[model samples]
Target: MSNADSSTKKFASQADLEAKKTSFIKLSDNAYAYTAEGDPNSGVIIGDDSVMVIDTTATPLMAKDLIRNIRSVTDKPIKYVVLSHYHAVRVLGASAYFDEGAQQVIASRGTYEMIVERGAQDMQSEIERFPRLFSGVESVPGLTWPTMVFEKEMTIFMGKLEVRLTHIGMGHTKGDTIAWIPSQKICFSGDLVEYEAAAYTGDAQLEEWPATLEALRAMQAEKLVPGRGPALLTPAQVNQGLDYTKDFVTTLLQSAKESVAAGMTLKQAMAHTRKVMDPKFGHVFIYEHCLPFDVTRAVDEAQGIKHPRIWTAARDQEMWHGLQAG
Candidate 1:
């Protein structure tokens, strides 16, 4: 690629400079969502005696602001830090909770394995890809290791409220987990669902994702705190988020399958996928940053590559330049 073409903007999210104001929305009496425009979101679940945080922000410094928000609502200690998956942007800030007296960091077995396998590489890759999101990267001490891990599901109670954490099939990643409160019909879906923003599918299980959405819908959640976008407070809004995410995943995978069937190259598949998806999702946040990665994964899945390759900072540039140059 030419020097001008290989500028920072060509890499994923390198040129994104806008600052987004954070929103702390109450989804129910016990559940809340911390969203920032279209950035990754964190969920707060407050029970009678303690609190459980779902997905810490990108760094310890960023999580401090979330802690301040939690203090505004309840003084209960943050007893648990639940990771939805092992993404750097999602789990790196976990130590901040431990500093604030969080008793344990929790995740699924698959997520724990991912951390052991690719945590370091993903951290470096993400920090370079989205500089603004990792504004406090220096504050991240190291990989956030989970103190507790479950197989399929586990339930915990804080005073009267019961929080259900389940490995609801894989979508965004192989170890996707969701926090569900049965009594309130509320769920904290990590990266499994994105409302208005683009779904980052670089590490996704595309074929299994739609069925996972069905599993999420079966909960009949009245309130949902999605991974990105504003909190869904009503049942209708919750359905909309699920449907939008399903459509995005379905469309991308379908386009990629067709490209593969026609024996198209990766760059050609990406172009074709964009031609189909841009009209609908182009206006969404991080659509440009997400599509290249999304299509690359879709193409891989279509060609029978079940697991996504690890993305290092160097691999990210190579892929971007190769795809964009073609």
Candidate 2:
């Protein structure tokens, strides 16, 4: 069906009103994953004397649920709030952890710079796109700024547990960060790896994504908590999650490159992508929601746009309608 079809047309950032059932899974002795169906995920690392929250939900009000889960098992103070990346849905709820004894809000230097560059625009853009995810948006004080920013990788000790947070390379976003616990052989890969859900590529670096995924694979994580989907509790599952993400991104970019080589318009490229990906990924969560943006970004990269263009609410509509019109 054409994007103009009223009945089947799904807007880029439209609403999915159904509340996703959340899963709070223990990946290891110290690590846990909070995932909602196919919505974004947050990771928890309980250290010796304190705890760390990987990504906050959307707003302070929404983060209460995750905090409750953390409180159930351990009463340790929430010492660090790590932004897997600077996306609004992932980082905006950081304020909620301060009362839990949070001392530092952590992110990569790349992520911090992105917040400075487009955090405001992305805030409006995301709230408008995924309205339900941000129903508690009013509770957000403002953009979440990281207090501790790292360049390559930094290690934290939870008593004797060695937890390392690293920025291997850019995949989902330029500043994507991952948490690794060496003792447990567990990795909390932010949005870099998705198991059953489509990876959001609106702000992604398409060309470099695969190599970044490979870097994650080299970790040999025995357990992994991906950005979405259920928590992976085994090495086999970890490899599966990695492969699924790599396949999706590589296929999307290749389709875009082929379309560009043949001089296909954006709309035509969308059609081409659907023909190849639909049979494989059509039924996955948010595939419809993410495909257009994925194709748009992939096409841009193929045409030599290295840095992803900043997305604003106004630009969101323009691009949505632009795709629909043709």
Candidate 3:
């Protein structure tokens, strides 16, 4: 595909991407999810005297929609902005929240380290890969900095409401987390649980991802706002979303394993996995953008490679070529 077609394939056009601000659904009396038309999800929790936001959108301009939605509800000052991981698409709009008087921006220790180590590289790579998502690219100052960092788990109370944030291991990334509201059995599952969209595993810990999902399942969330797709209301829909994500991970790893057993190259292994996964999950958002990277990482992991290597712009183009040929 030409670069123009490639760009269109990956990024949703600004005109095509409609941000539908939904009325806040009360997970409990204090917690709510301010979801758009699946552009990028942000969470809202009205604490005892403050409000906490989960995951700012891709750009500050895009985040204004979230801010507008927040205005519709209580006027509590946004006290905290919690990042589920370190991806720019999720955290770049953080400054917008801070402008509204957010007290501290929180992220896991691993995510904090990632911003220090590979943030610039990731910013360049993702911008070149998906232009439309980063509509106001020139406006982003740099990686969003996390003011507060945690090791494993942290608990905070908004008056009587209890909110638990836990780092559930290296699933989607080294510092993946899910915000749990115990009183309502609701979870703001970041990229750890994709409803219909393809889980981007470029920076994932494959062996540990399944166990992390299992841990999330044990939470028994009645309502969940996943990393992508609509809010899962029923228990059955939640289970289906979890199972679908698991299936994607399982299929990629198993295909890579079979290819390794047959002495196939990484390119060959990726082709095999795509052939297998497309029939099952071809229509999800960013499926093409994610699959090649997912297979490459899975193959490396299957061959006993522990850590995922950093992806530069050069590496992305090289992998895209290899996958497209198949």
Q: Tens digits of per-residue lDDT for model 3 on 61-134?
A: 87787788777877888888999998888888888887888889899898898888888888888777766677
Query: Which is superior by TM-score, 2 or 3?
Result: 2
Q: Relative to the true structure, how large is the alpha-carbon lDDT of every model? A: 0.92, 0.90, 0.80
Clashes of each: 0, 0, 1
Question: Per-residue lDDT tens digits of candidate 1, residues 51-103?
Answer: 99999999999999999999999999999999999999999899888877799
- What is the RMSD, in Å, between candidate 1 and the native fold over all Cα? 1.8
lDDT of 1: 0.92
Lowest-lDDT window of 10 residues in candidate 1?
Answer: 1-10
TM-score of each: 0.97, 0.97, 0.91
Clashing pairs in 2: none
Off by over 4 Å in 1: 1-12
